[model samples]
Target: MKRSRELQEELDSDSETAGTQPTIRPVFKVTQLDSAIDDELDSFAMRCNLPPHREALAFKTYDEYEVHYNKSHTNRCLECRKNFPSEHLLNVHIEECHDPLVTVKREKGEHTYSCFVEGCERKCMTHQKRRMHLIDKHMYPKNFFFAVTRDGIDGLSAPRESPRG
Candidate 1:
């Protein structure tokens, strides 16, 4: 763990160039003892009959427990170091938050589609812009179901040459 932290610091410092955010995904190590304790604790939570581990390390502080829990039990986002309780939520987080970083690389260098709302003339060039237009201008919720494309809103016209955001 110490070695990994040192390596992460080195990577972060190297990547801290002007106008760029450090995007290194920090690695995590899950010890066998932690894995066993997590499994046993889940079983205990479900009211399953199980004996406590004789050698499980007792956490001393909230921070200790949180760190161990995040490392051993949670679906963690390495890029941002946020932990999700379930795999579905982790995937959703990746889709909504981190996936845009990849999609931005695929932009065609132009605005491809107009806003989905009726009577709205805003043209959006990327996934985040399209999403923001709906959320900010039309009061759409962050998790709104409008696909980032014209076909998603209305299929009345021919498809654009640009890809779906």
Candidate 2:
């Protein structure tokens, strides 16, 4: 898509490039990871709980649910029945208060890292294991990360034709 001036202005304001490179805007590629997350959240059951009689509401992203929760719930879990003061407390509870009985490796450099998809307890000691989990366990397309991460070879990277031709 052609870059618009309004988009350029928005990007320029937020990016470190500022006026350095006025034409560049990083493009994001949606992958199975995003789809998986969205699919799980497509039927968010907690949103409609604000009004006792209201029907359940669906959210495409966690941020949307968080916004609704911050405004309406004050403190609640997206997938849990328990109520809390806010996400800050929830995060604190996990980071500081949670018992050592649970094993969720959040550090990237750690020997083991939690799965990319939520609700998946499997941890990975290597990048290949993580990729295998996504592919084997989740049945994600083998090429899902093809262009995004350049993980596998495909016809995506076309050879540039000679200008003379």
Candidate 3:
């Protein structure tokens, strides 16, 4: 009878603690008008569960760049150093691993896409802009080669065009 009473008291104490605990809820807000391509990118990011800001999207060759333009830029996982197609996939990884050692912080900025064409100082603000520059300016093929590896090295391939970046 005494053990039963003790167990009951412990349960009651747990209930009280749970009742007193505060719940944390994620806050979401939409602000201001953005470009349609930007909106599409945002939608894609959300769908993939990736952070909004990415550091770099470098390709060895303009051909590789052409291939990756339509797809999500791959990023290296800080914890495992493995490459993922998108930040969304990385976030999913964190969740799946339930890694206490891993931490993710969202900084304010859009994903950066760079032109790997040698001496062509073309750094696009968005992937879509880069695609436009490649197709319209450089006449890259509408269909291009997509690299499967995310080695994160920028200077893997030679530039097709003269220095225009």
Candidate 4:
């Protein structure tokens, strides 16, 4: 029994020492061909996502100088000199070329009204223009007239009133 116990303790210590040895594995491995194959797969996947109409359409690149010939010669346009990768470029072009910076003088009896909202004094010439201004600038709530009441007017009483006799 004492011999068996001594043999068992010796075997356990040998196994623990063997487990502590570091493992050897492959490292720093990738080739140019592997990277090329990855890039090709990514481009192929992107091409597959496009619609049939878009895929059929030919890719066209136009000369910017030829596109803006009139503006290039006469005016000092920054947009012509450089490319702006945004939807705002057209708006900037129109404001710079067609529209004058100073306010235009209006003739007598021009159709204009002060904005109905308090603190806003902008004059709008048409109902559509006023509605647009309210929507874009003030961010006024839709159904505001029904949902809100003017300072002097009672909401319940105004709805119940008959036409003036």
Which candidate leads the pack in lDDT?
Answer: 1
Model 2 residue 149 lDDT score: 22
Cα lDDT tens digits, model 3, 34-135, are 688776555433222243325545455556655564333455556555544445435544433434432221123433444434445665664567667766
- Lowest lDDT block of 10, candidate 4: 146-155
Better of 2 and 4 by TM-score: 2
lDDT (Cα, tens digit) per residue for candidate 1, span 1-165: 255777777677868753376556666888666788776666432221212223555554557766655444466566665544445445545654566653564464655444655456666666678878767877777755544221121222432222122
Predict model 2's lDDT versus the native. 0.49
Task: Provide the global lDDT of candidate 1 against the true structure.
Answer: 0.53
| TM-score of candidate 4 against the unseen true structure | 0.23
Model 2: per-residue Cα lDDT over 54-159, one tens digit each: 5777665678878765544654333333333334334433432343433345343454534445456676675577677777777666665412122111223432
Give candidate 1 regions above 4 Å deviation: 1-108, 148-165
Pairs clashing in candidate 4? none
Better of 2 and 3 by TM-score: 3
- The local distance difference test score of model 3 is 0.47
Q: Going through the candidates in order, what is the number of backbone clashes in each?
A: 0, 0, 8, 0
- All models: lDDT? 0.53, 0.49, 0.47, 0.40
Ten-residue region with minimum lDDT total, candidate 3 = 145-154
Q: List ranges where model 4 is wrong by over 4 Å.
A: 1-111, 146-165
